[model samples]
Target: SSEVQMPMQSGRDYSLGEYFVEVKVGTPGQPFWLVADTGSEFTWFNCHHHKARNKTRTRHGHGHGHAHGHSHGHSNPCEGVFCPHKSLSFETVTCGSKKCRVDLSELFSLSFCPKPSDPCLYDISYADGSSAKGFFGTDTITVDPQNRKHGALTNLTIGCSKSMQNGVNFNQDTGGILGLGYGKDSFVDKAGRQYGAKFSYCLVDHLSHRDISSYLTLGPHHPAKLLGEIKRTELILFPPFYGVNVVGISIGGQMLKIPHHVWDFTAQGGTIIDSGTTLTGLRLQAYEPVLEALTKPLTKVVRVPGDDFGTLDFCFKSEGFDESVVPRFAFHFTGGARFEPPVKSYIIDVAPQVKCIGIMPIAGNSGASVIGNIMQQNHLWEFDFSQNHVAFAPSTCT
Candidate 1:
């Protein structure tokens, strides 16, 4: 059964942006327009030939209208310092075959061949059902070598989708995503073999706004800082596509008794741990406690307009107020991995005048929260399918 993305399209809990995600199959010495999304996995890029329909780049019936019903426009390549062109760029494809050698005309990389007959294309699916089709090649991608506990990435697939669905509200400079899934099919798995089955990142904490942060570990570089022992619960772990079971949940140190079936990853729209969404979304029942608890701390604030969903907004104007005096959010996985996000990360403001209820209230209505990057800004996360558990290391987003 297809998982239900009730209320929202993604219905994710937390989201992270500026993620040190890497796409391995990228063209050497190349920079692409990519949006750091936590709502979905499978990082991709724009390919050379794409079929544009309705003045938009969509056809597979997997993206935009069919899957999530959201329209996405073409992405603009980032030309400023913010783009990671030089860092993750490479000289050519490591394919080693003359057949896969250079096509000077194709812009993404120097390894493109002018005339090719290979179906060297990738079909990338988004939570919204819109898909991107592109060519898949190999390249080395890197990140965060500035600090001691650094993060470096290599050998991942990045599709070059010619067209994409609209999600412009979120900075989408690239026409693709830096996928973060599991197993040999994933870039980390491919490059890890040569680079020592490992990668690391200093996850930033959006809450503290601290300089020091957590780490995203792969292989031996996982589960650091005595993150406590495993508390195994029931979680749905899908090796085929890469999805997880919710297992259970906790709030401010209290574990709520929800059905094991509801959290099943197999259940259509059951639950997904996305780092791209800005809020933690749950089904009608799932979102109640989180929303209720969060409301207690708002001593006095501003109320504002909202979308179709009863989206709430609040803000305060105090000289010295404590933002940390509230209930905590802890998502207890079957393996005892308590995915806890800072309240400040959830109690976020979308605009200068509005304070959006971070744990976005959806699912109950007709939308899913595509886990934005806001929730993930401060934690170290690892997609460990080999072990059947994604790892986490706490850190501050610098």
Candidate 2:
């Protein structure tokens, strides 16, 4: 099997926004910035509709580690530069096929189909009320391997979204999302079958300067020699999400006395590592004790009054803040993998002199906790699907 590794750079959209990677789609190879999401399964891109009345010409431009361009004065934005009709290698998957009827039925909706011979359409509704409607197709996707060699994967499954609603507020500059989930149609699974089932990424600090960048590699690769001691943990198999068994959490060396059921997967509570989510989320049962333990150590710091930033509940005025006093948090997972995140990862700066706890609490009794991108910063995370293990080490990603 061939080995491939690609260097990915972070996006400049927002500090809390998803990480973006440059990918060339279609035969002629038009570049686009795609959100790198391990929580999703289907890889989709905005498509240019020929019959659509409002058509805007897209001019490609490079900015902030991504190749993206935009145009105004049009009511509806053009899907993107690559049009399926223009791509010679593009092929639409017809409805009623095995891939469309069975495989896709589990991941997407087929309620609006008109005929069996029609293109396999999908309507994906997200938990945040964002939706994308599109037809399934296949085309070429090109990426630059770490060996400095250009490689193109042909006939890859992709969704050419005809319409999207309130999903990430995509403009002409933003193309679409690239799914890296464990589903059969995911890019990670497909590429893993062809190449190797190992991928690793090092995320820079979210508050890092725009010029600083991180890296993402596909296929077999080793961490840089300068990285700290690497830790290995079992990668729990959870569809569409990479889960890890979190046994307990500790603040300042004292473990919180949370219930074991809060970390049980069978009880609808477990921890999942997701790059799409900005902030880490915990169930109410686990969140309360963790928050209490965190706040107890910060008695010296003055709490900001009436400072609420949506999901973030803990806020403080950082006028004369000393970060050295902040308590360190350690997340203990099954197999004895202890993840100790830096204090800066939890106490994030949202505004000038305003810092808040980056983790949020999920309002449900039954749902998986999420280790969001912010919590994973400044660490090298490697996902080994073939071996069913994930490894991490502290690193200065930039």
Candidate 3:
């Protein structure tokens, strides 16, 4: 198989605050926008429409001038949804199949299956409190459907979600999620294995014009030679996440006094690279020291309450703020790998003449620290599964 590359668009224009790639699934190929999530393990689509019950409704069968209002269990089947029955190549996975018994054992429960030939069902919940209930199915998937010359993959595993909870945080234009996790059944693993067990992506600046697109590339087509000095680091597997080792963080070349346990994998905390999250989130133990060191020189700048910036604790008037004096920030990783991002990546522009800290502490100081998309902007990141390492380099993403 040859390399496959797809254009990615930032969801900021749609108020979604994530990144998405266009995918074509099923027979005759129906195009849908799917969130490119490395943290998710299963690729699924919204196969059913969510209707608001408990709302007022009217009945006209009585033929009299009367209004009947009540909540009832009535729903339109497959209306404006991804109906698997309509697809010519859709096939449900049996409960006894290898895909359901082994590859999907963690998500498919035996209690949900009464017979060996029953449809494999799955119910999964995300960290953001959103949940989906569905069954497993196989279908054809294509990258650029309009141009059939690229070809399509048949009998690929996918989730056919019947209902979704907590629909408020989702992008209305997005029809589903494309799982890029490290599992055997994940899209990345399947697609990457076809070429050279390698995949790469270069995220453009979040504030760039909509016409300027980022890209998700599969296979071994990364032009590392043109991107300047490439840094390689050992890849740590933390199950469904791409973990990286962080020794310390330095601002202006001065390392802060953060505890070692903050980055220790055994301490229930570590660092992972996630493209789904918008901002960088540091553990509480590591957040305080880093924040203090960054603000020491900002004493002369006007400080405002966090509420003004929404979730960000640090905010300052951008009128007299000089970015040159902000100092340089770098992350020291294992194997002497250092990542130095632009100053504007941390000090973000919000409202007019207002700047706030783009990095924040994780809620409740739990879970692993996340290196999100904002910190990774303007750089090409490559995952070499065959070599057991990850590489990165600066790129214009043109």
Per-model clash counts, in order, read 88, 0, 0
> Each candidate: what lDDT?
0.45, 0.76, 0.77
What are the clashing pairs of model 2? none
Model 1 segments more than 4 A misplaced = 1-28, 31-41, 47-125, 128-157, 168-172, 195-201, 206-219, 222-236, 239-247, 253-259, 266-270, 297-299, 308-325, 335-337, 362-372
TM-score of each: 0.60, 0.87, 0.85
Per-residue lDDT tens digits for candidate 3, residues 218-315, read 78785433356889888888878988889999999999888888888888888998877777889988888878878887888897776876578899
| Candidate 1 lDDT, 101-130, residue by residue in tens | 543112233343444544344344554345
Who wins the lDDT comparison?
A: 3
Order of quality (TM-score): 2, 3, 1
- Per-residue error at 229 for model 1, in Å? 8.6
Scored by lDDT, model 3 comes in at 0.77
Off by over 4 Å in 3: 49-81, 94-98, 108-110, 114-118, 146-151, 167-169, 223-227, 308-310, 363-366
TM-score of 1: 0.60
Q: Give the TM-score of candidate 2.
A: 0.87
- Per residue, candidate 2 scores C-alpha lDDT tens digits across 1-398 of 36555545555444435677778887767677687777788788888744422234332321212212233334334345457765778888888678888778876947455777778988887654677888898898876533266677778889888778864424345578788778865688767766688888887776665466666677787444336788989999798889998989999888999889888899988899987777798899889998888877677777775345666788888888888887899999888989998998888877778888888888878998899888988898889987899888998876
Name the candidate, 1 or 3, with the larger lDDT value: 3
